[model samples]
Target chain A: MLRRLIARWQGIVLALIGIVATVWLALTDQLSLYIHPGTSWFAIVMALIGAVLVIAAFALTPLEDDHQVASDASQPGPAVHLHEHDPTAPRSVGSGTIRAALAAAIIVGASLALLVLPPATLTSAAAAQRSINSETSTLDQDATALVGGDTSSFTVKDWAVLLGQSPDADFFAGRSIDLVGFVSSSPDDPDNVFYVTRFVVTHCAIDAQPVGVPVYLPGWAERFEPDQWVTASGAIVPNPGSSSAEPLLLTPDEISVTDQPEQPYVY
Target chain B: MSPPPAPLRPAPPKPSTRPRAAVGLSLGVALVLLFVAIRVLAPEAVGDVLSNSVQDFFTLSISVVIESLPFVFLGILLSIGVQVWLPDGFLLRHLPRNRVARRVTVSLLGVLLPVCECGNVPLARGLILRGLTVGESMTFLLAAPILNPVTIITTYQAFGWSDGILVSRILGGFVIANLIGWIYSRHPSPMSLLTPKFQASCAHAHDEVRASRTRRSVAMFDKETSAMLPALFVGSAVAGLIQVAVSRDVLVTLGQNPVLSVFALMALAFVVAICSNVDAFFILAFGSTFMPGAIVAFLVFGPMIDVKMLALMRTTFTAKTLVQLTVIVGLASAALGLAVNALA
Candidate 1:
């Protein structure tokens, strides 16, 4: 009875967990943590549809004797049916037990991950694994247009693109810049240089690529640890060190710890 | 004329099943409330207990589920519609009579139903049960993700006819899908390609006729969820684990090599398990570092086969068949990528 019940309801249970979690995230304005804001409406709308179907399913299918009624009413014959629901005639009792156990595990795992766990942005570990500033082509913009545009509202991504395209230090030498991002140490010059990084999400967090602008600061490790959010403002200058690959780096005049913003990624 | 009159027994009170619906509804409501309560009451500090990597594993896995869940629901709902609401043989009757032409028409069905690759699994399962040949269903599954409007538009937007990346992906996906379908169409027993359990499902689904459409739809929702969600969760977890374990530097380092870059990006595609609609933009991040061929390979290979896609497909196809499908698709995509690179 328990096996049949689980086999029948696991999906609906999972659907419920996902719907509740999604709706909650939407309500709290935290959906962007996982998916892009552009897709949030679609996710929310689908969740709502799934919720209605689930409720309708619950209201229509009686809890008790559903297997007997469903089988008899749907198809009258020898009880061959959906494989997951055929526990009574399993080829082996062990296999049936195993299937049931696996189903239960999925239910429990999904519930815990989706419901009980708190929502979070991708951490520094992901950033480190993906390697900050390695893939910034998505941040690419026309360099000439960037030089002529208003510079004060530019993001770290905007600056990173400029640094990549027009790295003629003369262009950035006198330009004061301000940016907010998590800190990740440079691979080549870990001791003196760290990057101010943020993930650029195209569709969802799964596709998020880390983009950062290098900041040259000696003894930076003593004050700021990796993954700590910071707001740094300074003038861009030619790289004084020979270790880092970047041609120009941000030499901050004012740098301080800051809170992680509501939307940690730039789309 | 009975030899003896038997005493009547109380019929066990019939168990009052009239209230069962109410009970079920109440339980569902209670479950939702319980989930919400747990979510609200869970400690924020609980996240801090785990190390960053462990935390990221959960975060990444959860995000995949959260991102793909709705599309999965949409697929199942559509599956229900196809099986229950549509008249019998509605889809099959409209297709071309010739086998190859039928398969071609089937592959183009993606233009109408633009569900992502993960969602296509259930829909394909539905099509097979609805009298679509196994080979044709396979074609639909593979081609739908690439040929769909959203994916094509996104690829266009990302590359804009540059270096033939967009053209290569579309043509590659279409040709590979058709080739697989044609190869499998000649099999003496194509049903052997499916898992025993799914075969059993196909067998019984054909005989079902007496139930009301509503009941059958509900039952299908239950059965499909039972089959699909477990696989989806497991697939998501695996995708997440691979991302954390595999270093992108290893792959990006090979981006400069014409031949190796094709394989490297294909490997990246297998691990990332990103949705097809947005993968072009995702791969655009590597546009500068990787050769156009590598980008093309990533675009072509990713939507059809990935860790998550394999897991979901496992629900229907046998392990041996999946291995074959992956190899063939991988080779075809690599060939397309290398050709584009040589020309460039």
Candidate 2:
């Protein structure tokens, strides 16, 4: 029965699991947590189409297919020709059973991962693993465009680019910045400084690149844990400390914990 | 949609089957509702049991799965259309009789169907079921991702003919795909290169089972997903785990060395497993640090093979075949990268 179920119903079960998860994510407005917002429609639409197909498959498929699958599953040789009904054939029952069990395990595992777990944004661990600020393409913007523009709407990625392009303190002398993102410690000065980090996703979380704006706050770890979402308002100042490598850092006038935004990753 | 594969009998499905269909429908609806309920009401703290990195690993893995699931469905739908609806031998009859010309034609099919590599696996399986030779299907599988219109346009948008990145990717992908096709076409028993179960599936696909197109399609969907999704989940998990385990700094530091940079980026490409359509933009962040050749290698090698691609392909190809495919594609991509670097 397990083998038969694995052969005939595993795909439908898995597809349904995926379809339900995707649609729920879409309904909840959290699909962007895993992928770019631009592609959410495509994912949701395809999922709906898949859901219909799964239902249609369930409703329209003849019982013969099920019976054929069961009979085929019972015949146990691994070779392609084993379906040709050779009673004397040596059956590889052990391997076939193992394969079926593995398939069953995959079905269970996929359900638990997709259906049971709460949706999440990538953490500081991902930021550190991909290494903060190592990626430049998504961060490659016209820093010059921000020179005289309103700086209130600038994201951490914008400031990161501006920091890279306009290194002089005068460019940022009077600009006050307000940014919101998860907290991650500066690699150089973990205690005194932490970065306001957001993943810049070009397509999906798989291609996400960590971008952060360093903030100078001594003993910040005592107040805020890594990956804690926070809102910070500050001035961009030249790094005040001698030990840090970053030329510029955000010296915040006010910082407090906040809820993670509806969309955490900046596309 | 076209005529069903076989229409000789065309007998209407019996009324007796309607009750069974009702049962199947209820079962399916019940399963879907159960999944939704589980997703909605499952304890939020269940995920917190895992540490941050572990949670991130699942997030990344789930992300890959969510991103690719739709494409995989689209692929399977297309596969079903190709196998059950399209007229038999319609695709094969038009191809050139000359083997090399046939492969050249096959590789360019991707330009028409722009689904990325993940989608290509099921479509390739469909083509094989529809009587395309395994070699030609292999050619389509490798060539389609890079040769597709979306990938080309994205590459163009990202690089804009700089350092010959766009031109090299297109030409290199074309050459490498045909090279694989040509080599595999000469195999003594090409069927041996496929997994036994997949080979059996091919044989069964040819058996001319008589059923309504709807029935056949659903049946095909069941079989295809059973084969494809397990591999996809496992592949996504491995990809996520590697992303959490490996340090990006180790790879980025090698970006300055022209030779090591090529291998390093290739390794990165293997692990990152981003879709081919957007990878040009993804890698552009590293464009300043890495040589053009390394980027070229990445563009060429990644769509054709990666942790995810390998798992998807493993459904259809044998372990030995995959190993050979990896080594050959790896070497060819490396050589292409090195040659481009030299020219630059």
Candidate 3:
């Protein structure tokens, strides 16, 4: 009885793990970090239904009857006419017992790890590795603040996009700005500028693209370590960034260390 | 009215309740303790070194599973419904007997059933039981994941509504699916390509369902879950690790060459099995980096094959067949991508 009970718990355990993970992410309002805004609600609904169905299986098909059902499901009579269900008929489980157990261990182990650990957001090192700013075009459609009007409203992502649109840095000579991001040293930067980095996620953290604006902190860029969140206020200068065409650099008059935002990733 | 068959047994059933509970609780405790030790002993040493890329990967993996799980269940439910309610007569009656007509009918049927590659496997099995030919069913399996309407609109939007991408994806998927299906029709015994057990038991699905609805559904769910889910976790973990660890700077360098770019993005598509519904958004980042043809290849090939898809496919197909599908899809995508690059 105990062996049978252990074996039957396999599907149930997987279902429960899924349910727990989905519920935790949703309740914490962290589901947005993992999927697109357009599909986040849809995922939540799907997860709810999936969890319910898995739970329902416990009652709908009792543990003792699971193997019996599996036997029935796997039996395709060689006979010309379909015979009614027969337990006596030959059945095949194949090498399923060991394989299902292994799969369950890995899946359940991963789920539990997520629950126990404090959630980690993407870091600056990955931003450097992925080396993608191609999202400047698709990551933001909100930064259409009339070219000269309230340049202060732009974040690092908006500034990155706006700066790329114009040919000469002379276009935005002096625009006031307030921005927040983590610091990562720009590759091949002779001037030693620090890029205020923000990872923009379009659809889940997997597709996150790094975008940043150069901050001319000169001696101060070295004061902070990588991935440390900071906020700065300054005026935008028509200066070329480390890479790409005429990127707007920030001449932050005031800068301070800050805590990470409630949502670290921008949609 | 023969005597009840003896339960199949080899070893005696040992009492496992205490051992099972001990195993579960201790595993949990061990994991918690390991993390807690790291947090306490050298919190500063640990704080920055703990790469959130792994965490973020897990988050994405779990999210992908949860997001798609509903549809998988729905597919299972649909497959079960067909078995219990309408396995015969309904599908066989509507499908044509003519060879070319059947292949075309099912390939176009890809539009109605908008399942991604992962979710479509069970549904394809169900369709086969409903009497689709191997050629017809395979076409649905390959094409539905790539050329579905949801994928269409997303690809359109992902390219910011560039008609070139939209047109090429449909063309590439249709041409490949039809050609593959046609080729499959010539085989002496196409059923030989499927896994041995599935080939044996598939026909009995209807009779089994009729035996008891609960037993059948439970059985079906158990089979589906066991066959696919473990590989899913392993595939996600491996794919995520490689993506995070490997620098994409080479990807950028390769993107500049039209020929290399086609191969590169196709490779990326295979490794990163982003769902077709949302793959466009992923590819949009590469739009500025890679050529139009390369991006097109990424879209065309990604949903059609990937590490996750391979793991899922392992449940149904032989390794030799999997390799053939990969080569066919890869060459087709590359040819289409390169042709576009050369012409336009």
Tell me the whole-model lDDT of each prediction, alpha carbons only: 0.84, 0.85, 0.65
Q: Candidate 1 at A256: error in angstroms?
A: 1.6
Whichever of 2 and 3 has more lDDT, that candidate is 2
Please provide TM-scores, in order, for all candidate models, with all chains considered together: 0.93, 0.95, 0.82
Q: For residues B1-344, what per-residue lDDT tens digits would candidate 2 score against the true structure? A: 11111112323557557676777778777777788889999999998888989999989999999999999988998899889998888988888999999999999999888898999999999999888888999999999999999999999999999999999999999999999999999999898888756766776676546676777887788778888998999999999999999998999899989899999999999999999999998899776889999999999999999999999999999888999999999999999999999999
Interface RMSD of every candidate?
7.4, 5.5, 8.1
**Model 1, span A124-182: residue lDDT tens:** 88888998877664454566778888999888888887887777888876778999999
Chain B TM-score per candidate, please: 0.94, 0.95, 0.81
Best by lDDT: 2
The best candidate by TM-score is 2
Ranked candidates (DockQ, high to low): 2, 1, 3
Q: How close is candidate 2 to the true structure, as a TM-score?
A: 0.95
Q: In candidate 2, what are the lDDT values of residues A1-267, reduced to their tens digit?
A: 556556566677888888998999999999999999999999999999998888987776553353344334445223325445544322467755776787788888888888999999898988887778776433557777767777878888887777877788998888788999999988778989898999888899988888989999999999999999999998989889836688999999999999999989987
- Superposed by TM-score, candidate 2 places the C-alpha of residue B67 at a distance from the truth, in angstroms, of 0.7
Candidate 2 residues lying further than 4 Å off, grouped into runs, are: A62-73, A76-80, A83-91, B1-15
**Model 3, range B15-63, lDDT digits (tens) per residue?**
5334443444444345334433432343333333455676555555655
The DockQ of predicted model 3 stands at: 0.26
